[model samples]
Target: MYKNIKVIAFDADDTLWVNETYFREAEHQFAKLLAKYETENKIDQELFRKEIENLAYYGYGVKGFILSMIECALELSNYKINPKTIEAILNIGKKMLNEPIELLDGIEEVLSSLQDRFKLIVATKGDLLDQERKLEKSNLLNYFHHIEVMSDKKEKDYKKLIKHLDIHPSEFLMIGNSLKSDVLPLIEIGASAIHIPFHTTWAHEEISEEASNNFKYHTVANIKDVLRLF
Candidate 1:
């Protein structure tokens, strides 16, 4: 099925290494810090809304998330949020930023096997500086031919990337965890996509069952399974 595929683009966050997990932990801490003001469920919902609202202004990444968190805290607290809590929130973001980049199991093995046979690229959305830091620390940078830190993962974005890579849609394949950012967009652009779900997913990345079945793409249990496809 992949005989025509020459370029394989990977999503760098939860797909290649630990990312969403840290965000989840941060969210938990954020919720706890605001527990006195609102219920955990309400705090979670509001934070999500704030994050989406801030997407245009901040784009995607931990930095944006941290800012949204602060906004949510202020709104939930009716602008009377304590300064110490704000400091704690900032510390949470700091700890997340400094977290080690632990590569997913079998990621290195699969990359090692495929790098010689195909053009590998990292196609992900995040703060450019943070993404670069993680990639450098990951020790997997040498395997990719190119790296793309996208501001948004949409059909237009993938189309531009495909053009820049000089590959046709049919010649490119994307593998990632998010159906929203990674799989659906590539499929919409006439490219092949493989969905390898991470154990944790951001709420925005979740898709309806009907939508998942509507797309014609491959699904794998893990990154290692990608080896069988190629």
Candidate 2:
């Protein structure tokens, strides 16, 4: 299946190290901070809405998420949120940025095994500085030929990356956790993709089953499982 795939791209966040888990933790903390203003359920829903709405302006990553939390807190509080509470919300983002990189089991093994055979790169969407910091901390940087911190993961974005690599879509393969960002777009562009779902996913990244059933891609239960496909 991979015979024509010369360039293999992997998502950076949940696929390489623990990411969505931290976002979940931050969301829980955000809900607690605004408990008096609104119910947890309401806060959670509104924050998600705010994040999606802000994506165009802030793009993705911890910074955008922090702004969304603050916006949600302000609206839920009727613009009466405490300054210290705002400070605490920022701290949530800081903590996430500082969290230790917990590499998923079998990531290195897969990278190591594939590095010798394929041109590997990190095809992900997030703040460039934060993504670079994580890669540096991951100690997995050397294994990859390039790191692509994308603004968004759409069909055009993947097409641009493929064009930059001077490779055909058929020779490009993507592996990541989010089907919306990683799998479906590649399929649409005539590229191969493997879906390795993380236990957690952002609401924006989730897709309907019917939306994905039409696409042809391999969904593996674990990262190591991808090796067998090669």
Candidate 3:
């Protein structure tokens, strides 16, 4: 199915490294910080809603996420939250920023194997500087020919990327953990995609089974398994 593929774009978060797990952890940490204001469940729900609601203003990544947490805290606390707690929330984000890069198992193997056969690139959505910093720390930077820190991963975004790469949609393949952002959009644009399920997924990135039931794509158990397609 991937024989026509000339370029392979891999999503950064969760696909190449452990990302969603950190976000989940951050959410839990956030919940604890706001525990007096609301239950953890309510906090999670409200924070997710806030994140989606603020997407237009903040976009995606740690910076936006931190802002969402602050806003959620303010609302949940009815604006009664202490300034010290606000400082603590900011600290949560700082700690996440400084966390060490934990590369997924076999990620290097997959990239090393496929680098020579295809124009490998990182097509991910996040703060550009944060993504670049992670890439540099990953030491896997040299494997990719290009790195696109996209604002959003929609069909049009992929089309623009394909156009920039001077390749047809059919010749492009996206391998990532999020079906909503990485897989479905590519399939919609007539490109191929391989879904590598991550252990954790952000709520906004989840799609219903009904939404993906009609799509034709490949799902591998792991990143290393993607190599078997060739």
Candidate 4:
């Protein structure tokens, strides 16, 4: 249904490569460490629910994410923290920091197919170092003609990205996982968006309605399925 599209902006984390799955695995390991102090009943759903709600306040990035984990560790430990346990938790974060990058299946083929038809840009928000490292390691960096890494994906960043690329809103499409960060803001700017939800923890941004005709929206189960749009 989409046509006349000149540029397509892709979210880097969950949209292009595997992100939340690694975080989920780390969370499970973190919980096992926390288990020594707090009961399963006390810290199960409540903690995760709070974290999801707090994402708006904290935002997403490794620094804030690691800080939240440290806070959780301190709270659960009742201040009686073990050095080794703290070390282990820090190690998990470190591992994530330097983790090997793996692109989601079919990402290369899809991008290659669309490269000649659309101007592909990597539009993501996070710590610059981490995001750059991930892109470099993933080897998918060269596919995107441009990269826009912002502190946040609000109107300001979207406007700047489009302006910098010299592309009009009608000619740009955003593909991402976070509705709040990627889809909604771009839609507000009169751009098209596609939502590719990952099977992992709750993202603060969730879509509540179907997309309107002026703005196209497509929701897919995974990254590989996103290729159908092009």
Candidate 5:
């Protein structure tokens, strides 16, 4: 079914491997820090909701996430947490830079299989350095002919990517975890999109529904299963 697609762009992070799990763990630590000032459940719930709101304003990236964490820390602690406490939380986020690299199951094999017929691309958004490092460490970098590390994934970004690739939207396919950031924008530009839900999703990425027929929103259980389509 995917044989006719010329360019298949994949989202990194949760779509490629484990990412939301790391963020969830970090948020748990932040909740612990708030225990003295507020109930853990209240703190966690508020932070989770606020994080989603922050994403709408700042979008996704390490810097925005750090800011959200700072905001949550301050609010949950009733504004008593000092700069040092904030800095410590920020440091915890920075340490994610060195997190171990591991690809989703069958990612390697599927990339290998698709390489023969499709032009593979990695289209991910985040802090440039961290995203680049994760790609490099995964050893999956070699498979993609192009890499798009963006601060945001708006429709314009998709247009630019298509223009740069010199391919029409109909010939391109975007595979990702987030309907907000990945699928919707690309589909609006007439490209096909595939949605593969990660086990643990970022608060900002939760979508109301998958795309309807107008966008060709295919669904998959996991990244590895993409091979079956090809």
Candidate 6:
């Protein structure tokens, strides 16, 4: 199916390494720190709402998440959240920032095998500095022809990326875990996509499976399975 594909783009976070897992852990820690003010469920819901609301203002990544956590803490505490709790929240973000980049199984092997056959690039959305740091730590940076840290992942964004890379939509293939951010948009833009499901996904990135039925894309059980496609 990808015989014509000349450029293979990958989603860095969950696809290449563990990301949402860290966010989930941080959320748990945040909820525990605020347990004095609200139930964990309510805290989780409010934090998610705040994150979505703040997406445009802070964009995506750990810094934005830290800001949202702090805002949620203040609101849930009725503006009397303890300064120490705020410090704890900031510490959670710092811990995540320092966590090692644990690459998904077979990522290196797949990249090594395909590096000679296709132009590999990382097309992901997140805070630029943090993403660059993780990529540098992963030591997978040498495999990609380009690194695109997108502000958003919509059809228009993919269109712009294709134009920037000087490739026809038909010549591009994107592989990622989110159907909303990764698969559907690429399909809409006339590019091929492969969905690799991660164990956990943020609520905002989840979409009904029915929404994906309209498009033609591939789903794989493991990252290594993608090697079979090319």
User: Which candidate should be chosen as best, given lDDT against the real structure?
Assistant: 6
Residues 59-168 of candidate 1 have per-residue lDDT tens digits of 99999999999999999999999999999999999999999999999999999999999999999998999999999999999999999999999999999999999989
Would you estimate the TM-scores of all the predictions? Answer: 0.98, 0.99, 0.98, 0.85, 0.88, 0.99
Error of 1 at 175 (Å): 0.6
Could you give candidate 6's per-residue lDDT for residues 138-226 as a string of tens digits? 99999999999999999999999999999899999999999999999999989999999999999999999789889999999999999
Candidate 3, 1-230: lDDT as tens digits: 88899999999989888877778889999999998878999999999999999999988999999999999999999999999999999999998898899999999998989999999999999898999999999999999999999999998999999999999999999999999999999999899999999987888889999999999999999899988889
The parts of candidate 4 lying over 4 Å away from their true place are 40-59, 207-216, 222-227
Give stretches of model 2 more than 4 Å off: none
lDDT string for model 4 (1-230, tens) is: 46878998899998788887777777777788888777755655545665655567666666567667777777778888888888998888898887778787778988988888888999998778889989998888778898888878998889988898887888988888887787878889888888877666344555455643445578888666767766
Span of ten consecutive residues with least summed lDDT in model 5: 207-216
Worst 10 residues of 6 by lDDT: 81-90
Per-residue error for 173 in candidate 2, Å, reads 0.5
lDDT of 2: 0.94
| RMSD over all Cα atoms, model 2 | 0.7
Candidate 1 similarity to native, TM-score: 0.98
lDDT per model, in order?
A: 0.94, 0.94, 0.93, 0.78, 0.81, 0.96
Clash numbers, per candidate: 0, 0, 0, 0, 0, 0
Q: Residues 1-230, candidate 2, lDDT per residue (tens digit)?
A: 78999999999999999999999989999999998988889889999999999999999999999999998888888899999999999999999999999999999999999998999999989999999999999999999999999999999999999999999999999999999999999999999999998998988888899999999999999999999998
lDDT of 6: 0.96
**How far out, in Å, is residue 130 in model 5?**
0.6
Residue pairs in clash, model 2: none
What is the lDDT, from 0 to 100, of the residue 126 in candidate 6? Answer: 95
